[model samples]
Target: MAMRVLETITNMTQLCQKIVHINIRWSVLNKVPFFRQSFRFLWDRILMCSVGKSIQYRRLHRCASSPSPAAIECKFASGDPTTTCTDYDKDSDLVALKISLLGDCQIGKTSFVIKYVGDEQEHRCLQTTGLNLMDKTLFIKGARIAFSIWDVGGDHRSLDHVPVACKDAEAILFMFDLTSRCTLNSIIGWHRQARKWNQMAIPIIIGTKFDDFVQLPLDMQWTIVSQARMYTKAMKATLFFSSATHNINVNKIFKFITAKLFNLPWTVERNLTIGEPIIDY
Candidate 1:
């Protein structure tokens, strides 16, 4: 009888393990990317309080009221699961800025974005397949603006599908390399395509590799800038000459975007735009 009882217990454990594996697989395929992260986070917390040392974690959390470093770290590392959801909650008016990059392949579009968010520029960037979506929240003045930037594929073959990914963007950043004439020429087509996605939105013309322009003929460089500025001005778009390698006015671009979109007073700096309006539209 004891042998039979032990056998039954073992079978139950095996069954539970199989069930857990199947559940994880389903979650990974159907749920958000952060679902696994959330599971791991909850599991870690549970383990810390149970099998692991509970008092140490409690002290760590107590040191920081509200969201502890541990919690913020988890959110940053895991990314907010809310952003991946297909539909956002309509009740809450959380302003979400959809930004996309438009330029030729290998034109430092991805590098530029990573530099803004990661604060570093490296040539080791792999081609973005389909789309790469990331979120960063900036606190300007007093409000918060959540930026959901999508780095779409810059491959020539991928141009047809690019507009679909850029739908509902609050702004589009058309990036071109200062040294690459091919990338610079592609900007016109990219801008036309992006306009189809969001007609009334703002477009920011960004000239990458601004540092390298000194090596090129000054007249040629100014002519390029003039052509870009003319196109942007015609479309009522903003233009900026920036080098991600130098981090010049990278902060200013985001801040100015906040001010333009939210129509906040220009005096406040480093302030996030508030999503909630006093009067509901």
Candidate 2:
């Protein structure tokens, strides 16, 4: 906070100096004594106006009750379940990131969230009529990263919950059942609905039940993979073949999200093999 204030002050000071220098140069070039005399009065008013507006803007952001944006990021290592995901609900400094899960019913949308948030936190989930909300707080480095995950029911009634679930979300996960092609097709609709509420949230296409998906014939797997890749391309999203049951690519997905959000180095390589759990960006 101190550093930010100092930096803001230094930047405003330099900017004021530049503006004053430019105006003084203009007055001197024109060789007008009256303009020179007026420049001092104008300069005084300009500096006062600039400082007043800058202070006003800073005051607006200085609300003590509002949650601050996440600045301290901990190294989120992929494929390691122990890196984070603790129950840090009381931490006032915890930077909360909202994530919405959209998919068809029985397509493992809730299961996918449970897999990432863990079974212990499953009891903490707040389930209402159409929406399922769960929270997972991660202790990273010295800061807390909380994920407020909203899973909307796949039924038609859940459409009402989409707007609330997606509004101000940091990322939205579009899930599908790998064994069901119709479920995969519905993801585009879900994506459209989510975008209506938030166009800036990171879009991710997740194929659930990958374990069962691999049990199908090799040709079917190839077809499903190709279709998934095509949809991923169309949506301009990152695709991950996941299984809540087997826990494949479950933790890794959130790690990828955390790393991306904080601009951390992502060490996971892309995999396009049909039989393997694919991770494509």
Candidate 3:
């Protein structure tokens, strides 16, 4: 009976050793690229299954108690966020400005705002129902500028609210989709309304979806550019071609506008191709 017990113990020890060997092999396999990718795919699937979509949108507001400009960060909340005191320094003589974005429906206004504010892009595009407001504070040439950006919906029903939003705006960004010629043409009416509301506001003409626009035939590309230049000249507005998705000229647009508005000396270097304008493509 003692001999039988000893044999049983030896078999159990061998089984335990085999189990440890299998675990070590698995650990090594996880480090391999192919096995790692396969594991990641499975893990993502498991996570998706476990956490079904229950996504919620929260508004971000800045806290007033934050004393320093660098320390001010957005605070998440359930309702429409209000402006915070950190947006200005009373002692520094900060300037508060309102900027309005005007454009037709589905013309990438919201996408531009999201990209500017460092937010993730939404996979599906949705129309803005009424108005969406975002605030950003910028330090330019020893002066603090607080901007209250208002994005008004472009539907016909939302047109009534445009005058109110544009009433005291310091600057206006008029956007149009490059893929749609109708949207480009509609800018005239939008510009007219903006001028009627705030004649002093600096106007900027932005051509959105520039990535898709460049894929068109060369002649068509030049035609749109010519039209943009004509309208810009007539309206005395700065012209910019931008693609929020590709991050093309997105930051430059705002920087140029701020510099122009503040009368700050700004210079941009570009390689000229003989016939092309020196603007950043």
Candidate 4:
């Protein structure tokens, strides 16, 4: 009985070895384009049921034991795992500015930021729950300025947190949807609320979705633009018409603000033609 048990144990060890060898061959075969799609489902199931966990454990252990020195140095230098060594510049002046976006819900505040930052646009508009923060570094006039942008949710329930988020903000962008009169009407309230939190921050009124607004009848379009201009004057804020989807007036808005704040010179191109409109977008 002892001899039989020993033989069985030896056979089982040999079988596991053969299975491992076959798995290795299968791994190589799985990389082939012709076999990949056909074998992927079966390979995944086999790995999950047999060797996946063990292989992952071994790999993690190996990595834990021997971390690369270059990676360690990079981690220490940046102090942020998401930031790489190349992203840091020793000679650039790092000025941190906080800007808050305030507006009614679905008015394209988040969309505008994403477009300006060169991020992919979401197909569906997402309602911001409380506050969404994004960071961007801009190099203007040989100076590096880092902007910390906060997008405050426009929902009534989220409005309570707006004051807290707006603290220490250097500027506030109050946006409204040009196609929605209700959103435009709500701009004054949003501006007041933001000013209550940070009075020193410069305020700018942004009229979004201009592409859709322009498609309306001439009279209706003029009405909306006139109302927006009135609000801009009343609030003593600069007004800009923008379309994030079309990448219009997005970068120009930020550039104008930066130039104004830093006392930098910015030249505006004028349209000499009498009947033709100036194309600034």
Which predicted model would earn the best lDDT? 2
Cα error of candidate 1 at position 252, Å: 1.7
What's the distance in Å from true for residue 26, model 4?
81
| TM-scores of the models, in the order given | 0.57, 0.70, 0.61, 0.61
Candidate 1 residue-wise lDDT, 160-264, digit = tens? 667766776777888878777777778888888888778866778777776675578767776776676676767677766667777654545665565566553
Which residue segments of model 3 deviate by more than 4 Å?
A: 1-92, 120-128, 267-281
- Runs in model 4 deviating more than 4 A are 1-92, 120-128, 267-281
Report clash pairs, candidate 1.
Answer: 139-272, 140-270, 140-271, 140-272, 141-270, 141-271, 143-272
Of models 1 and 2, which has the larger TM-score? 2
Among all windows of 10 consecutive residues in model 4, the one with the lowest summed lDDT is 272-281
Per the 3 Å backbone cut-off, how many clashing residue pairs does candidate 1 have?
7
Per-residue C-alpha lDDT of model 3 across residues 183-227, encoded as one tens digit per residue: 889899999988888998888888898888878887777777778
Q: What is the Å distance of residue 27 in model 1 from its true position? A: 50
Compared with the true structure, all predictions reach lDDT values of 0.61, 0.80, 0.67, 0.67
